[model samples]
Target: MKRILLLCALVPFTFMTSAQNSRPNIIYILADDLGYGDVSALNKNSQIPTLHMDQLAREGMVFTDAHSSSAVCSPTRYGILTGRYNWRTRLQSGVLWSYDPPLIPESRTTVASLLKQSGYHTACIGKWHLGLGWQQGENGKVDFNKPILGGPTAIGFDYFYGITASLDIPPYFYIKNDRITATVIDSIKGATGKGFWRAGPIGNDFKHEEVLPQLTQKATDYIKEQAAGKQPFFLYYALPSPHTPILPAKEYSGRTHTNAYGDFVLMTDDMVGKVLQAVKEAGIENNTIIIFTSDNGCSPSADFKELKAAGHYPSYIFRGEKADIYEGGHHIPFIVKWPGKVKAGTTTATTICLTDFMATAAALTHRALKDNEGEDSYDLLPLLLQKGVYQRTYTIHHSIDGNFSIRNKNWKLEFAYGSGGWSAPREKAARTQQLPPVQLFDLAKDIAEKNNIAGKNQEIVKQLTHQMEIIINDGRSTPGAKQSNDVPVNYLKYR
Candidate 1:
């Protein structure tokens, strides 16, 4: 009887060990300001040919109604990392600046931290706009030579090599594992036209055009190094390109017919190809899971007029661009390539938020998330494998300005009128005209969000509004113990 019991115990233990060893390496590739229509596979009319991105889409599961948590860079990044709404934090509107203090609190658990606890070698190699703790010098100047605290390393990532903010925002320098790679002794002047970057302090060796390539090389090198090891790795490769400074390398410049921005998109696609090639070269392609998504929609810096003239629509069939409350603002490309796990050449219209990444990782690693962690995240493992419908009750959307919108099934309700961001009939203009107090759209019938039926559907507006209030007050969308928001948030006040 003792021998039989020992055999039974060892059977389960063997299975558990095998499961741990089979955990796939995860690589999350985040594209900066790349829109849904930017990828050729998603949008047939896109002038910029994103072959590599298309290939990834074809080989993996593509989510059609995926969105960034917020309509802009910093907030979306915050939601992606923390699995909580950015509006709940002190920053209710706009993006964080280059030298802003760390936004993520020390106590907060990030996706990296969760995975790190699961024995994964985690690294964040790219734009970390969520903020960093820069050591201040005399007269409140940022000390670049010192090690910055409360950054990727401080949070959860074992290693970090990236820029602090957008490519355009400066203190233009590279940070490798919390330390500046070089001393910033000079100030670079701003440039106009396509390659636009704010004039600010820059490292002596930093170059605008070299940012994307350098980061790509670093990511590829990291992948190669990790592949040689037995431990499964997690890499958050946040891309800086197709966003600003539109500085494609000499070889990539003029590669597209849609001018500088399109050329930059092509370069971004090539970088994606390089990363994919790196995984394959390392002989870990089959065991690796690559998730390619954008931080948010395309910015107006891409020159909508010029792109339209060249027969390219960055927002695709959506109504507005990046910072608006419309679908285009947050609706982004979400593709996952998990070889032998997720079905290939499959697509789903399941609406998912970038915030879901945390919970998904937790599920993959067999870790049960605590109530305080991944507050807004829903496990997407089922959706990835197409096992069943992972129905989301609702998704809250935030704009560049402090406007709010809620989506429940096919119905959407915007709390404020106008674009609620940077678009025609802006908040001031719409208010001057005394537009409706709110807007409602049936997205299934009208994906463009053109016809608002708020006056007709009073019950839906009330229900959605009530749901939003509940979600806000509860401090989370997912089921858990009641939590508290960092600050006060009243979405209705925007009206």
Candidate 2:
């Protein structure tokens, strides 16, 4: 009887250990300002080849209706890392500046933190626009030489090497871990080009054109180093390419017929290929889970008119570009490649948000999340594995201008009267024309959002409006206690 009891007790423990050890290494490759149509695998009419991106999609599962939590950079990143909407934070609209205090509170749980707690090594390489606590000097001047506080390391990442903000933003320099790689004692004037960066303090050896290649090499090196170790690793390789300062390397210049932007995109694709190759060469390709996605839709800074003339539509069939409440703004390409786990060459129209990363990671590790954590995140592993049906109850969309839109099932309701961004029929113009107070679209019927059926769908409008209010008031969409928003979130006044 004693011998039989011992065997029974050890069985569950052994199985649990095996499951924990079986957790694969995760590499999340996030492209900056990449559009749904940019990847050839996702868009049939793409002008750029994107061979590597296509291959990844072919070998993995493609999420056709995936979207970023927000239509801009920092906010989307916040959502990805925290598994909570950025609007819940103090930053209600726009992005954080390079010199601003850390947007992610030290107390908040991040995806990296969750993975780290699950015995995985975590690193964040590339653009970190979520903000850093730079030490302030006299007259509120930034002390670049000092070790910056409240950065990636302070939150969760064990290693962090990247830029503070977008390539166009000022104080251009590179940061390794917590300190700037080089001292910024000189000012670099702005240069003229299709992709221009703002003039600001620049490090002596920091070159804008070389940032992408350097980051790619760093990421690959990290992967190789980690592969030799026993512990699994999580690498958040945030690419700062194909965004602004479209400086493609000489070898990649003019590689595409579209324009310089296209050439930059080609370079970006090549970078992805390099990382994928690194995983293969490291012999961890099958044991690694590679997820390729974008921060948001393509930026208008890509010179849409010229690209359109060249027969390239960055937003694809979508109506608007970045920062719009429309599909084109937050809708992004999400491809996951987990060899022997996720079925190959499969596609799912199941709508998902970037904020879902937290809960998915939790589910993968078999860890239970607390009520305060992952308030808006839904576990996507079920959908990815095709084990069961997984769908979001509703997905909230936020724009650069603080516009709010809610989507439930096939119906989408935009509380704003216009695009709420840079596109035509802006807020002022719409008001001048006496457009309706709100807009509703049957996304199933009009994917382009050309026709507004708000008047005809008053019932849906009321239901969606009430649902949105409930979600906002409850402070979460997932099942939990009613939490509190970090700030007052009034959707009516565009706050």
**Steric clashes per prediction:** 0, 0
Off by over 4 Å in 1: 1-21, 388-391
- lDDT of the structure predicted as candidate 1: 0.91
Model 2 steric clash total: 0
Off by over 4 Å in 2: 1-21, 138-140
**Model 1 — which ten-residue stretch has the worst lDDT?**
384-393
User: lDDT per residue, candidate 1, 275-385, as tens digits?
Assistant: 999999999888899999998888899999999999999999998889988998999999999999999999989889999999999989889989999899998988888
TM-score of each: 0.96, 0.95
What residue pairs are clashing in model 1? Answer: none
Residue by residue across 155-251, what tens digits does model 2's lDDT show? 9999999999998887888889999888546898887776699889999879898999999999999999999987899999999988998888899
Give the lowest summed-lDDT range of ten residues in model 2. 15-24
Local distance difference test scores for all models: 0.91, 0.91
In terms of lDDT, model 2 sits at: 0.91
Candidate 1, position 140, lDDT: 86
